[model samples]
Target: MERILVVGVTGAGKSTLARALSGRLDLPYRDMDALYYTGREWAVNDDLVATVSRLADEPRWIVDSLGYPEVRDLLWDRADTVVWLDYPRHVVMPRVLRRSVRRTVTREVLFGGNRETWSDWLSRHHPAWWAWTQHTSRGREIAHRAADPRFAPLSTVRLRHPRDTAAWLAAL
Candidate 1:
């Protein structure tokens, strides 16, 4: 599987897995978040389509977190493998919370010059909150998409634990 899509709920280590896969497969890695969030605009921009198409032109790549239907189809449709990091709700929610708190406290820059703030951290839309809310939601989302004929030919793997993910990545 050359072109791979590493998908999961927020704070489920999607970017971490994507980087590991890129190294294991000797392919380039791209963070979909960087393309989706441009500091100039808070919302998704038009450049996303071009970036996705351009990246797909490469023979091998690992993309982390793609959710927009068009963007999802572009990568998911062409990706040879879909590795979902389906960690437990308890594990991910805590991790996301910790990460968010640390980032907000440190004013860490993320995704194209954007920085997490205390206000954002407290907001309902914070990724930490999203990680919690979207926990079981992803399974439901994936189930329907997995059933679609468009994804019939895909090589799918949903890893529930870090050990399985590590072993799979190491085997790659």
Candidate 2:
């Protein structure tokens, strides 16, 4: 539990879970999104590599994100625990959609002014769209990592339903 990867499809409560994990484990909470989203141009500066290296040296941390392959190696090599919120597609999609609506309506700035617009919400690149398209694809990849012999010692807790995830976290 020293280093935990809290992963899930878009809007599957990854950030919330990661925060809780950080509190429970007495570790730092790293929002990978904030670390990766660097500028107005949306380009990741070379500093991400350095940040990852620094985080890896720490004895404990809870990282929240799933799409950055560039930092995957650093995280995989250091994490001993992975909390996968493998909620059903039906559940995750609605959660994402609602979150989008709220953010857009409120003009909530996320990840340093990265915002949710109604038009973009309806677009293909929307978080909802990403969730729909990437859920099973990424989910399968995570499943493979959990079961693969190369990662044999990794402890993966795959929570299929929200209630199940809640119960598991409550007991932690």
Candidate 3:
């Protein structure tokens, strides 16, 4: 597929899948977190809609995002396919916790020169907590969007398990 959108809750492996798909499909990869963040702060481009709309006009690209409310419609309208990582909470929570721990321990730099810290991991706004609380709601939202008639042109591949995701990527 050409314009692909990888969507899921935080720590659901959207970035990982998008990167792999970009390499396999020979499409450029973009992460919304990088675009929206600036040095550990939320600093969206001045004209976010225009910027994203312009990016969507490109011939080929794969994007990973949390489906920000402001740009969800734009992304859905532009994407020819959506890869939804819909792993269950039981599968996702531990992964998120481990990822947070590893990032914190390693001081791994992330988008916008940000690094996860133990204190940040324990914060209410932590990615692990976000994923735990938003897991079901995010899945439902993606499913609904994928089924919507307005987005009929967009196809979706929903992978409910980590193994399913692996198989799907292998088959690609």
Point out the higher-scoring one by lDDT: 2 or 3: 3
Instruction: Compute each candidate's TM-score over C-alphas.
Output: 0.92, 0.93, 0.93
Name the lDDT of candidate 1: 0.81
Count of steric clashes across candidates, in order: 0, 0, 0
Task: Point out where model 2 deviates above 4 Å.
Answer: none
- Model 2 scores worst on lDDT over the 10 consecutive residues at 37-46
Per-residue alpha-carbon lDDT of candidate 3 for residues 55-137, written as tens digits (9 for 90 to 100) = 88998989998456777898888899999998888888888989988999998988778888877867778998899888888
Candidate 1, superposed: residue stretches over 4 Å from native: 40-43
Inter-residue clash pairs, candidate 1? none
List RMSD in Å for every model shown.
1.6, 1.5, 1.5
Model 2: colliding residue pairs: none
Candidate 3 scores a C-alpha RMSD against the true structure in Å of: 1.5
